[model samples]
Target: MQNSSPPKMNATEQAYHGIRNDILTGRLKEGERLTETRLSDDLGLSRTPIREAIGRLILEGFIERQSGYTTRVAHFPEDEAEQVYEIRRLVECYSVQRAARLATEEDIAALRRIHAAMQADTPPRDQAAYQRLTEANEEFHRTIVAAARSPRLTALMTTALDVSMVVRTYSMFSEKDLRRSLNHHAELIDAIEARAPDWAASVMSAHLLAGAARVAARLKTAGSDDGQD
Candidate 1:
């Protein structure tokens, strides 16, 4: 049989994904300097690949350059986040509307499986468990996004979610809010199963806004303290 394994990532791909993952997961803090020399050493690649990766990151908004000079991880500005949320609201609502019409039994089952795995307790304050929680949360939403089956929409929303800072905000959700979010997930499944686009879109819209508000509040507080958000 011919080999079926996936192709190995090139050095530039490796460096790009490593740096991007750190930015998304908050391992690379906002405004932290991205020195090509350090990244080349850490990723065990040459400066050429690291430079390429940084360039990609700049184009994708994972990092930015000031006056096309110093490179650093991008901060999640409140205004920018709100603008992204508005775009997400439109994209995701349309997605759920489409998913409600299009999701197969297999798709519904897959979504349920992810939803069931989500933590019911207050998300752990620890780093590792929290990382898993973030992954699960992304999986839950991404499954639904995939169900919509629009490559263009998927790519657009993925960029927004990468910068949304949802994980940072979700970890700080009040117990009540966390429970409410989970309950909304369950109800969303019900709407999808019933193939009710209006119902599913409604739930998703409210769910997003609730989380956005919480994150905005956190950003406000952070601004008062150290401007981390």
Candidate 2:
């Protein structure tokens, strides 16, 4: 007899992408309980696929499953955020240093284009624009890191980027915050163009640390808001 073929994704992968996108874009708010039946009805899929998707998400750190209870969107734990930032600081600094050494004029030019596009758009203070800008910013950072041409560093940075996205989704920023971020990007680009490895590394480190500080403050503020209810 012929060997049986493995099942394709069917409903599970579809459900997984839908829920994952919702979480990443903040459509599913943090700490919101995910009911299998409700999600099944909404997505027009069976509970089995929804459950499987949730399981996958749990492994990916996007959702948390409690024993004999409902799963929920992952909450922004302050400690986790801090630790991720620390790791990001070290990895990104090294990546920027190497990038500064290896970056070509063409690479710098492409980054400039991305930066200009980011600055032109008046990102609305809503989750949608926030999500768009987040992706754009990731692209900008990825360009710099890619210049380094180190596969190991790239892999580690990619994981950190995912964690960073989770942190950012919970902590929304104001227009002022966005503008400040753009300014920093400009400075980083300038440093890179000057071929100043030390300066580029320092700027990238400070930029990442500043972002961590802002996110920490936002988390505290959000906590206070929750307590008021």
Candidate 3:
């Protein structure tokens, strides 16, 4: 009998995903310095694969070049984060509207499953739990974008949604924020299932804006505290 299992990741894939996971799980953290030697040693791989992984991550906005042959995990400033969310709002709102009009039963079912997984992970107890929740959340949004059936928009979403800084923002959600977010997802599912484009768009706009507001408020508070210190 043939084995039924996923293929093992190659060295480069291992390095890439290992580093990315560390960043997303908050082990590496924003602005933390990184080096090829350190990563290669840590991953038990040669410099070649680690270097390639670092290059890909840098292009993907997970890592940033620093002064003279150094790099650090990318940090999104408040304005940059606001801009990213604004772009997401514009893109995702339109996508969800189209999805409402065009989504198939399979698409809706997939969304429901993702949403259920998200609900199950709610009030993420630890950093690892939060990481899983964040992944489910990402998949939920991506599934909606795919349901729009626009290849061009999906490609754009791939880039915008891949930002590590944005992924990390899920860890910022408070209990109230988490509940409100789940409610938004439920409303969105209803709107899509009802085939009401306007309703879906309205709910999505509210959802994205509410999240942006929460992040903005938190950033402002952090800046104030830093100033006081």
The candidate that wins on lDDT is 3
Best by TM-score: 3
Native-to-model Cα distance after best TM-score fit, residue 32 in candidate 1, in Å = 4.4
Q: Any runs in candidate 2 off by more than 4 Å, and if so which?
A: 1-29, 40-60, 68-70, 125-128, 163-171
If both were scored by TM-score, which would come out higher, candidate 1 or candidate 3? 3
lDDT values for all models: 0.80, 0.80, 0.87
For candidate 2, give the lDDT of residue 76. 71
lDDT of model 1, residue 128: 48
Model 2: per-residue Cα lDDT over 120-183, one tens digit each = 6646555555556666788888898898889998999888877435435434666777788788
Backbone-clash count (model 2): 0
Q: Please, what is the TM-score per model?
A: 0.70, 0.77, 0.80
* Poorest stretch of ten by lDDT in candidate 1: 120-129
Candidate 1, residue 23: lDDT: 73
Candidate 1, residues 1-229: lDDT per residue as tens digits? 9999878999999998788767755678888998999888888999999999998888767788986568988777888777766777888898999899999899999988877766532354565455566677778788888998889879987776763355545665776787778888898899999999999999999998988887788778868877443
Model 2 scores a C-alpha lDDT of 0.80
